[model samples]
Target: MAGQSKLSELFIKCKSENRAALIGYLPAGFPNQSDSIKIIKAMIEGGVDAVEIGFPYSDPVMDGPVIQEAAEVARNNGITMAKTLEIVKEISGTGVPTLLMTYWNPIEKYGPAKFAHDFSDSGMEGVITPDLPIEEAGVWLATAKENSIHSIFVVAPSTGDGRLKDVTSNCSGFIYAASSMGVTGTQTNVANTASILVERVRNVSGTPVAVGLGVSNRAQASEVAKFADGVIVGSAFVKAVLQNPSDPATAVRKVAEELALGVRER
Candidate 1:
């Protein structure tokens, strides 16, 4: 198993502060590579505790329309795995713990070992593989351990207790607790079942739990933070940039600030 990574440290720090960490997500080359960097920096500046830079893939099974549209824009602008890594290096350089959110096919195409090495070299602390099942993650898990990068897995409310234990045991960083059964997007109400799912995970593993999906504003962040160790906001951040093409950085920064306050208030 890999030792404590920056991702783990962030959770520890958040716990010490009696608050949930604010984790924000955005595609690597959304809008454009140069502008994407600015948007991410704006997220950090606005008080995001950690960052998850998405590897824009054509087929993102877990992503909703908002994220899917952002990925399409990145792909149209020629955002390759190499370009994604460049963005990761820049964001990680800001000294805020950074992670990569990617699908399994890209890692398989890049060669699991090489991909892990390159990701760690880029200064990323972890990788979130939403579609990679624990049963099929042998090579990827081993490679992630070899490179000293945290392997994060996503668990949903629909996951069985037995499966939750299996998946949580393999997780090195925080466990991503999807707030609902469906794909990722903002929701008027974050499912009440999310707290139940978090409790179930706690019964099996001591890993920190971060809730994502349907959390868009400060109130939602505070609500999730009440039970989770971290609150993850993705679609809302992507939408901020998507809606404000002329000044995307400023738009995302404002959203980040609002969500940051949510985590702290909880």
Candidate 2:
């Protein structure tokens, strides 16, 4: 028998532990390169089980103000695929599974096969391509599969049952379920549709489901954790980095600790 993929193993571990996984996101080179790496380390040390580091796309259509601003700062700092891979390599050294969240264009520019190979060789476990449609994901999927890297696709409230099935069926990692039909950011409250979507996903697939978008606080994380196998906290953590750029590690640590506690509240 074969062993499990890194992502599947993480979800399985969390499932056995009776709590959702805390997945944290941070844009590489944000606030500055040194601070960005430190921030991610802080979260992992604080309790994050896995990480998604944004590669800073020029057009972040899927992200909200917080992530967009942080990405912009990273871009202005002259971040590139090379730099992002470097960050991923360093972060993965912590033994926490790390993923790169990038738009398809960057992957296209980098050459899908080359990007996947380089990423996997750098010690990262997966890639989350937001804009890559399932219909057009063959090349990316094939390349990732060949490298033993997980490919995660996003499912939204508007995702039809057939599409949901298609997306989830192709998923090697947990399916990324957007809580609401909007860009990512901090929300005043969790989207009611979040639970419904996760339920729908569970009904059709055994792959773990992770809920993201607009999860801002511990309470919201706990609420989503009730239904999701992994609670993804992005914009809120980016906001923490923005608030204390001079020394963001402590602030990011606090946020991750709170979210980790929330995920285990069950």
Candidate 3:
């Protein structure tokens, strides 16, 4: 097969149908762990094509204000790596492809090899480590692959051509392309930049590219899907729940529905 299973095949299937996959991200224990699971289940019910379960870490330099706050809330609520895996197991019961987005620190602390085996057993479809560049991916990559866990890589707007090929060469699932130059939550009118990166990644990697990091609205998501296989809505979705003046679940469901509408429309 050209691309591995999990998200890669899922996006290919979606693309064949002339549709873009919707990948939603939410921290494991944001407002609360129980509430987080409920929101996840609701997201699937609301038509999310795939889900990224974020494992909250302390030094998330790439995240924006909203996700940083959500991580803090999760940490304050005592959401550890072990508990997060349990949550992943619970969510996988929904039968949707769910990946774990995390930093390398926790994996280092927990040991990448062991974490890979256990995480796959816990039902994670894949793992996305933005800070773990391809050069540094060794044991973790091998271990994840050995256990059938997809190991994803990220490519940014500033990534050069040669390095772009290196980044996506052995990537298991989809390649996450950062839309802007800055952190995860900042959105700009850089559709052309995103499109360029998407084309470059496709040219080299022949892998599915999902644009993330600043996509917060239906229009933005729709615009991005024009050239990308999928769209990742993160900070905006987290912001929706936090910005809810009244009901947070409603906020999540609303954002989820809007993105689903955006992806399905075109």
lDDT of 3 by residue, 114-142 (tens): 89878888778888998999888987888
Preferred candidate (lDDT higher): 1 or 3: 1
Better of 2 and 3 by TM-score: 2
- Each prediction's TM-score versus the true structure: 0.98, 0.97, 0.96
The regions of model 1 sitting more than 4 angstroms off are 186-188
lDDT of 3: 0.84
In order, the Cα lDDT scores of the candidates are 0.92, 0.88, 0.84
Please name the candidate that would achieve the greatest TM-score relative to the true structure. Answer: 1
Clashing pairs in 1: none
> Per-residue error at 244 for model 1, in Å?
0.6
Q: What lDDT score goes with residue 74 in model 1? A: 93
lDDT of 1 at 243: 92
Stretches of candidate 3 exceeding 4 Å from the true structure: 1-4
Residue-level lDDT tens digits of model 1 in 1-266:
34566778888999999999999999989989999999999999999999999999989989899999999999999999999999999999999999999999999999888888888999998999999999999988888888988889999888999999999999988999999877889474774878999999999999899999999999989989999999999999999998999999999999999999999886
Worst 10-residue lDDT window for candidate 3 reads: 1-10
